[model samples]
Target: MASFRVKGGLKLKGEIIPQGAKNEALQVICAVLLSPEDITIDKIPDIRDVNKLIELLSDMGVTVRKNGPESYTFNAAAIDLDFLETQDFLDKASALRGSVMILGPLLARFGTGKLSKPGGDKIGRRRMDTHFTGFQKLGATFRYDKKKEIYHIDGSDLRGCYMLLDEASVTGTANIIMAAVMAKGKTTIYNAACEPYIQQLCGMLNRMGAKISGVGSNLLQIEGVGYLAGTTHTLLPDMIEIGSFIGLAAMTQSEITIKQVQADKLGIIPEIFRRMGIKLDIIGDDIHVPSQKHYEIETFIDGSILTIADAIWPGFTPDLLSIVLVTATQAKGTVLVHQKMFESRLFFVDKLIDMGAQIILCDPHRATVIGLDRKYPLRGIRMTSPDIRAGVALLIAAMSAEGTSVIDNVEQIDRGYQFIDKRLNALGASIERID
Candidate 1:
């Protein structure tokens, strides 16, 4: 196992480029299975999750070749559906949440799919009922083997149908769209996730000859086509990573510029950060965080304490709530953070509290953070990463703390951020990789 030893109290300076969106890349790679020709994807992140998904695809007989750094050519014309039932495939599929996306394309093209229970951060119970319910609406039958923890889906000639999902799940929305794209008729999905990742999936499918409307709205309409052609696509920049960088700059009192940031795609993120008294300058496609003069939490309209929370697309992302919470610890005032989507995500505040942060965990979904305002910067301390978002949050806290801090089980962080230590080092962050 590898770990990160960071000496905090150093300001990060210079420019850093954000990596490709990991969530979007995973869905896009699986979409390749819908086409017979070669599909090339550029700007793919070199992270463990992406690597694991690629390995699963290769095991299914998809031809995945590295064309260049962060580029790949995939041909799923020879995919073997039988491989989906193997023990090796089950083990890998159960390791990442993104693996559930392959179910739609596999079922669409081959009429059946067998998958294990998908795994990811243990923040909450992310049910697949929405996914299966949507599939059932389109003429798919599901059989569950509780003892073996396997899901068997069987369908013939999926016909388009209107589906109203219980919630706006990002991966679940992507899966429904993939299955609907090759169905027999028109399919309408309500309460669909319209995040940038979902938008990118729709755009990529459109380029490959699938007709999908309402790209950035909660309602999606997909016109079924007999076949989709192979196409080349590039992924959007990782908004989560971009948010992390913003928090990093704020906490460390650094002035760093991010290149190629899709400013418009980051809906309400900058404005939310602005509420924390963090000023950002957007020069064209770049985001510049100037050196901090002061960090103060702005009050709400009624002069009440501001509360920041996460929601579906066009709202703040749940994935970045941890980073936001950590950044707020160094601000000048108090803010309420509500993480309604996940229960265990807010539990990581215990580590920050140990580092001299003033936080009150009100419940599983809420916390009150009183900032130290640079008067008492966090003291360096050792901690273990429990999950991906928490790992990044702890890293940001460690970077802004005094002295040295060690973060163990860094592989969790590696699953999301690509070359995090190297990228932060380029911006003058004193973080070293240790084994």
Candidate 2:
């Protein structure tokens, strides 16, 4: 029940390096269960969710050794399969949504996997049908125990098959790929999620001797292998954090340099911020966001209002829409933010509204923000963080507001961003963690 007391109206300067991708770390860490050899991973973000997954792995008898501050070597040589059925395992696995991924590798290698109902941000209804459905398509028997709220999967004779996914779910696709890699034949997955995280997972699987093609597209082809070897993988910089920093710079009128952001992989994020008139300079791998008093939102060619919507990869990411909505509050014009994936994510706008930002929560899925244009600076107020993204969004709004703001439930923010208050404080912003 910690809180953040943020002093507003501070101009941040200096450089901040984005941490390793949180999403990718979850998938690849679960992939360690696919092999019993040593797998060294670098650039791991020290965050709550990722650390929970790592702790889950350690509890499952995976030999986890810290090589450095951001590196670990995992060897799943002597996994205790009986642990999955224990109450302790259920308690730990139920707390992390990423724990669902472990079922795939366990089923692939040991032919049995059990998972308690996974938990994560309460943004909306995140169905597990995609993950289980993909497993069933790959010859796994699925059963849900309603009394205990646990999922049971057994795949003794897995074979390759072609299937069209009902939705392009990133974690679903990753889970299925991990299962299919050790199947008997080739598997083709259409309408798959091709985000950088998935691509990185596929690339790591390839390096580990699994055959996968179509790295950056919706269609993925995998040839089953008998066993996978160990390999080293370095995760990409978290794009969500980079986008948040960009929004923080614009909202607070600060000049900040984000170092080694792997800009090429940040599809449409930069342009989407630029559409809101945020100036970004891409020098090598770093993104330089300059200070600006006012940035104007761009409209369509036919004179319609600018719409920033989320899509699959190569489109705007839904994770950053919260940041966009908060950033647009201080812009020169209006922008419509459409958060299509999650229904309840835009609910945080009510907090920003309390901070003196003009926002119309049209519905659960869309919000229209009329920029105050610095004529009316937002005045800080007490608020509560709803989710990871929204929490960061509120932090940004508080940083650009006129007074001190107390944000409760900052644990939600820490789940994604590693030491966010400390990092931003180094850039000259004032954020104090109150325990």
Q: What number of clashing residue pairs does each candidate have, in the order they appear?
A: 0, 0
What tens digits encode model 2's per-residue C-alpha lDDT throughout 290-393? 99988999999998999999998878888999999999999989899999999998999999899889999999999999998999999989999999999999
Regions of model 2 farther than 4 Å from truth: none
* Cα lDDT tens digits for candidate 1, 1-435: 899999999988999999999999999988998998999999999999999999989989999999998999999899887787689899999987889999899878888988899998878877898889999999999999999999999967699998899999998999999999999989999999999899999999999999999999999999999899999999999999999999999999999999999898999998889999999999999999999957899998898989999988788999989999999999999999999988888999999999999999999999999998988889999999999999999999999999999999999999999999999998888899999
**TM-score of model number 2:** 0.99
The Cα local distance difference test for each model comes to 0.92, 0.95
**On a 0 to 100 scale, what is the lDDT of residue 254 in model 2?**
98
Worst 10 residues of 1 by lDDT: 77-86
Q: Pick the lDDT winner.
A: 2
